[model samples]
Target chain A: MSRELTVVGLSHHTAPVEVRERLAAAAADAEAFLRRLVADCGVDEAVLLSTCNRIEVVTCSKAGHDPRQALTRLMVELSGIGAHDGDGLLFAMQGREAVRHVFRVASSLDSMIVGEPQILGQMKQQFEVSSSLEAAGPVLVRVFHKSFSVAKRVRTETGIASRSVSVAATAVDLASRIFETLDGRVVMLLGAGDTGETAARHFMAANVGQIMVANRTFETAVDLARELSATALPLERFRQYLPLADLVVGSAGGGQLLDAEDVREVLRERRGRPMFFIDLAVPRNFDPAINQLDGAYLYDIDDLAAVVEDNLGERRREAVRAETIVEAEVDQFWQWFEKLQVVPTIVELREYADSIRRGEVEKTLAKMQAISEEDRERIHQMTRAIVNKLLHHPTAVLKGEGSPTEESRLLSAVRRLFRLGDDT
Target chain B: MHTHTLMLFVASACYIGASLCYGASFSRREAPGARLAPWLLALGFGIHTLDIVRDVVSAGVLPVATFAGGFSFFAWLVVGIYLGLQARLSLAVVGALVSPLAFLAVTLDAIVRGDDVAVPQALRSPWLPVHVTLAFLGNAVFALAFAVSAVYLLQENLIKSRHTAGLIRRLPPLEKLDRLSAGFLMWGFPLLTLGIVSGGVWSANSTGHFWTGEPREILAALTWLLYAGLLQLRLLGGLHGRRAARWTIVAFSLLLTSYVAVNLLRLGTRHGLGLAG
Candidate 1:
């Protein structure tokens, strides 16, 4: 009997965050849970993945047992929830559907924020835990590695991961586009609004030359600056820093902070070097008319949102390409799996032939002790070659070199004919 | 009609093919085309090098001594420098612009301009090859700078207009282009200075005066001064981005017109305005 590979889980797609959070397993509990499935549930192979978004148990059952009920029972018991609690919340997929589901999960196709990259790493962490606990056997090992390559293929072949989807990323993208690089370029963060801090962090990560965070409250500015390892300035004196700033991000509260005249004065000080301004505030901080200046570019929150939306659309289109890659990989992996199915029978046939040859050669050698040692060796070699020749066609058939039906039929016939037994 | 000419033609065809691949890669935003483009350029460069060597061997003179030879040498240097930059930096997008420039240079070099003059005995010093080679190499690097600057300006416009998709996505970052152009200009400026100095020395030895105001000589001097000023501005004034890029483009244009186009035109003038002497 062929063992079944199954995955039973609850994800953000089918359950609320409250349910997902309750179902999530701590790191220590995850390993123990995988151990329980193998020790008590008659599972030959097991892997448990627990994340903020989902908790899934993947397993391959032993020959005579079905693991679905055991997995469901374990999940209910572990979460302290009734079996019928979140009716229709637990999804169960078996066989090829299970494989495809795992691939999608690993590639971030099924992520809450589609195209987000965290899911792949989360899956890898789960696999590592399963591996350390000795729960991942041949089947889970093959499937998990294939899932990683499928995710990488999706990333490179398609632009599914193209463009930044957040306001901070959009600001950084705009800054890079305008100035070409942030290296040796000064950035001034106007106000310590959350959005401003996020964008400033992005600039810091990009290795911008320097960052000066100015706020109306001097202590907040100083605190944020210390956190980011940047310079803090008083809001009143922010204009002094603007002349040296190649890029400026404004997320301060309330009225216009810099008018057109102020920008003009700064531009004169900068000698007309290009400056990009990303205004991430409500009611706007920079003068809208600063865009009219020759070397000045200003974008507000709405502009950044439009860019993010456009990128999300592009990512959706690229997701279609990513889906095609996933499908092709699934087909490739399925073929490998089908070939894996015949491996045990083929190994049985080779061992059966070799054992008979070795037995007959030992008997013949014992009786021919009066003959020379060279002739005795020759007899052994001759019998080994004949056994190999006799078994070559049967080995090929058992290994699925022929049609699938023919291969399976021949495999059964050979097993019975050689009395190789059902243990294989 | 000769084997080297035929080989040069083949190299031009390869460059044209590489240009199309890079163009398709940019428009389609696909990886296969971008991956194939650089290999095609490297192949063309190899064949182009062989073609130049064949000409130098058969003619018993440096390949930069004639109009067709000079352009071919310049094209070879452009592709050579471009391949180096491509290896060090991700410059497949720049290839879309550069591959065509190389093709044009090679095609012009293959045109058989019908005025093949011999090198004068007085002008046949060892410095002749060094001066011409350095000049062409400097010009080749500047041409690359021009391509990068053009891409930079295009990318800048896209960002300013708030349309940062498609072609803009294909380009290298704005800062990378700025730095790349500046680096090339800085390296080329000194070689250009040496080329000018050596050319002056060669001219004085042959014609007895280094300050003659021939039109080509004056134009060459002006091109050199413009690039010198651009470099100084970048070093002292933090001159970069749009202004530095614009000046690099202008200086390269002047170099092309005075160095290649004027020589090809071969106009009848009072000072005999050509490099043949």
Candidate 2:
């Protein structure tokens, strides 16, 4: 009898966006689907992770049962990705291979954008859904827990997820360095150009306190503000609102509009609270000298782009380090998983021998009519010692480390000799 | 070795372990090192405190009467205050910088002080403990500020040079570091002032003048003045970031120099009572 793990899925690497989106299940639906898989497909444990890029079902089956076909059939019926049509798109891995896949996916090593942090959170969400539905059992609990730990190890030991890979992201990241959270911090868009507007949208997504758009043309400002559901102001009135803005992103075509003196007065007014200036304008709307002011951080487009480029190369180097950590963790988890397989068989074999010995002793006792109670007690002790002595060698042998072939042979022989059922 | 000695050695060992953990956290790709480091430091701190109490009980006086004992007491306060800040801010990366400083102080004391040095007759006055306590506590806080300032400089340099990849993420946000360092400086300055004033009174009572004209005393005065100017700049003139961080390093270095000259080098007339000798 063999217990196996099977993972059947399609990811961005194997399938296009249309198929992935079609296959993806909502959290509630994924939970229900996992519960159904456990109840109806003879799967002992199951977890279904459904995201925009992938939908994976990891299943642990009962001994002597295969979960691949059942999972494939379920995928066809539920996700509408037919086994026949999804030939090149669908991928299925079994046992150690499946476990490795799950680890890599959770660690973001297998993500479309390697080292992105979202996949780990998504994996955790999937684990929670399966657990709440009572679909995840001991094996899956072990797997997912190890996956989470491995992901965490990769994140800390390597710089893979630490650096932002893009300029816009680095800009937002720099804002975070100034402010702990953008939640209640005002962001002022100093220009209505495409670059400034794009950055403003990023700030909006970060849940800034308010968005104020100012442009040379009031009409342009108003249009941009209305589109973003933000307030608009004329370019000249930007100074009036400067004190309220925690961050100013400038990208206008105009020449230096904010000089050192303008910023010095603003700082005096704001009482030296930190302000970040992202100058995306080519001519640099904010004077470079304003950066000399205390609590004022300035970054132009070229500066941010340079940071992004440098960080990408560094991330690539960190990825190699991250991969090593993942591989080491995979081997560790696999060793534990393999050891799990041998314990139950050894326990069953010992139990089978003990039960037979007990049955024989009872039969002998019943047949021994009028035997003294003291003599009966002595006989019981003798039988117990004999069973213990007789089982010691086999137990030692079973527990000892051996080659896989030799271990499996011994296990099978013990099962056959004692007539131990595989159901246990 | 005596049981007290053994206990102090154990405490030192724990501090070394904690330092390694904190150092490892800086380079680790995983979160375990950071998570484990604080608990290890706390464990070391408990053992260290126990050893200090044991030493005081056996000696019938505060162990800070001698240079070695003073260094040990200083290290203990540094670790204690670091742990306090860690509890409040979860500043594990800061621990990487702090733990080694503590390890150096403790190890130095253990190596240098094989036997207790005689307590100075002047230091036997009631003002002694007050002055020493305030001084060491101030030093501990300033040590924290120095570590934070160092980090600030490194982070600012990284951001300025556009090398945002490797270490920046491990650090706390720049503004948080700035705010925390400022808080430490504000807390330490008043205590340091009181400590200096108490030292002057102790000097006047013993030596007949507050102005000793000793090299150590002059350096101490200069250190105080530098810190005063730095604080004034920050509070009134609103000097922050790069300039403030650099001045903090300078002030702390001067303070350290004056402290080492007075205690380690015995730059002035002997203050010790020579009872143990």
Candidate 3:
């Protein structure tokens, strides 16, 4: 049997969002679409991964058939694009390259954000969908399982997924370092500016206890607070509420909202519980000197940007290590797959020899009627041993390590010499 | 070698291993060492416990009368308390800071004395064991507090200065460390008070005096006063965070200084007894 693996996909790296969105939208009925592809195309096993960032089809084919051309046409049709236009948007890989592409995609190395964690979960969901629909066969099941482990290894062994690369995320990361968990902690939104609001939203996602939005315009504060399901306070009285806040996100444009003395008073009132301040205003809302205070941590926009830059650099270094791990794992998986190719031939050869030996022994026993029953049992055992001994060397030779081409050639030669069927 | 000495050597070796493993957890990316370190420390703790029991059973007295025995007992108490706290808090970095201190104490004990010393006739009293045990236990708790305070200060400085790189994550949260330091101080202060009272009782019974103005006595009084003042400030004055951590460190330093001066150096005490015993 000539089993081949193939992958065809378009990601953020290749196609624009418009192209990816069309295919992703078309995959709303993913199970039905995947089942149809497996039935219509030459694909024996198929999995479709459709996310906002990418749409990919992973398939296994047999009997010397390549599924890439069929899969590409289906992708073009689903994307609702012209065939000529789809040529450059979609990339195809076969054999070892295809297996490596699936691994890299599952591991998030092929993601727009190189080390983002969502792609692995998306891959797992798609794999589960296909397997549940019976569209994924044994081969794809093994491939997906191996890819999950490879992704896990990359995550643990390398620092690829360890740090935050965005400014808002970095603020939350820093806050977490100061406080063990953000749960039940208060957040005071000093201004309703976009940057500060974005960071506050990130804090809210981390399960902060309450959000108090204070904007210079009382109506703006009320509107924003209503949208966020938070409490609104007049900006003038924000100082009174400062002690209640564990994290202060400032984006109110203007010079110096609160100085060191203001923070010192609040820190004393809070009884030395640490307070983290993220100042997103251009002219710096909080005094830089507040950072020197014992329980007060102040970071301006520039500081958060610097931390994000540093984390990005760290992630890039870790990505290189992850790529090395992916390559090593790909090689190991490919070796196992190549060895799997000769398994059918080994089984067929054993069955062919055993059948001939059993038939000849039965015919000979029918002629030798004078032979004792014990002697007949001994003869049957002898014939079984002789057949096993005769086939041992050839079976070992077929299963031994060899290049892919050499293994395929040897398999074909054995099939031809034994006059075995061509269905395998 | 005697079984007692052999056990001590084995225990010391285990602590050294634990120290290196805990230290490795800080620098390495994959911290397999962190997982192994606690097991090594526990093994050493068990063996050290057996050795202490053997000393008490064979010698018919507490094993803290000599300088070597006092250091060894103090090390055991520190590790024992740390292991207890570790069950509740994930303070691996504190372990890195603590195991080396344990190793140093055990190694010093091994080097300073080769054989067990009998309790002197003058020192053999009911109050001797009680006083020494309370005092060393108090010192052990304070030693742990000192380690926690050091971590708190480092973590607080890193967060305040905005230099929190990878090392910040390895340390516990600032608030957690501060609270832990205060908890240690709260437990230790009462123990030290009882220890000081028992020591006074022992001194009066042995020397026929309720008060002695030796340098050792004065140093102990000063150390005790500093801790008492800190506790008073923290409990009544709302003192916390950096100031509280600093005070705890300062008071522990004085206690350490007094121990070295009076017990190891034999500076001013007429009786030359080691470490409260």
Candidates' chain A TM-scores? 0.80, 0.71, 0.83
lDDT of 1 by residue, B1-277 (tens): 8666677789888899899899888877565676788888998899988877766666555666556667777778888988887777978877877788778867777776333446557546777777778777888888888988888788777777778778777788777888898899989998888888887887787678786777667777889889999999987887777777888888888887776545667643333333521
Ordered by lDDT, highest first, the candidates read 3, 1, 2
- The residue ranges of model 1 lying beyond 4 angstroms of the native Cα positions read A25-28, A63-65, A178-186, A207-210, A226-230, A271-274, A292-295, A342-424, B28-30, B64-66, B111-127, B193-212, B259-261, B269-277
Binned by DockQ into CAPRI classes (incorrect, acceptable, medium, high), candidate 1 is acceptable
Q: What docking grade does candidate 3 earn?
A: medium
What pairs collide in candidate 2?
A156-B28, A156-B29, A156-B30, A157-B28, A157-B29, A157-B30, A158-B29
Candidate 2 or 1, higher lDDT: 1
- lDDT per residue as tens, model 2, B1-277: 7555666677777777777887777765554665677777778778778878876666655687666677778889988998887777978777887677667766766666655545555656776667777877888899889989888888777665556656777778777777777888999899888888877777777777887787766776787888888888888888777778888998998888777777766777456421110
Q: Could you tell me which 10 consecutive residues in candidate 1 chain B have the lowest summed lDDT?
A: B268-277
Model 1 / residue A389 / CA error / Å? 23
Instruction: List model 2 lDDT by residue over A155-270, tens digit each.
Output: 87777777887666789998886676788789899888789888998888888888999999999999999999999999999999999999999988867889888998998788
Q: What is the lDDT of residue B62 in candidate 1?
A: 68
Residue A305 lDDT in model 2? 88
TM-score of chain A of 2: 0.71
Per-residue error (Å), model 2, residue A131: 10
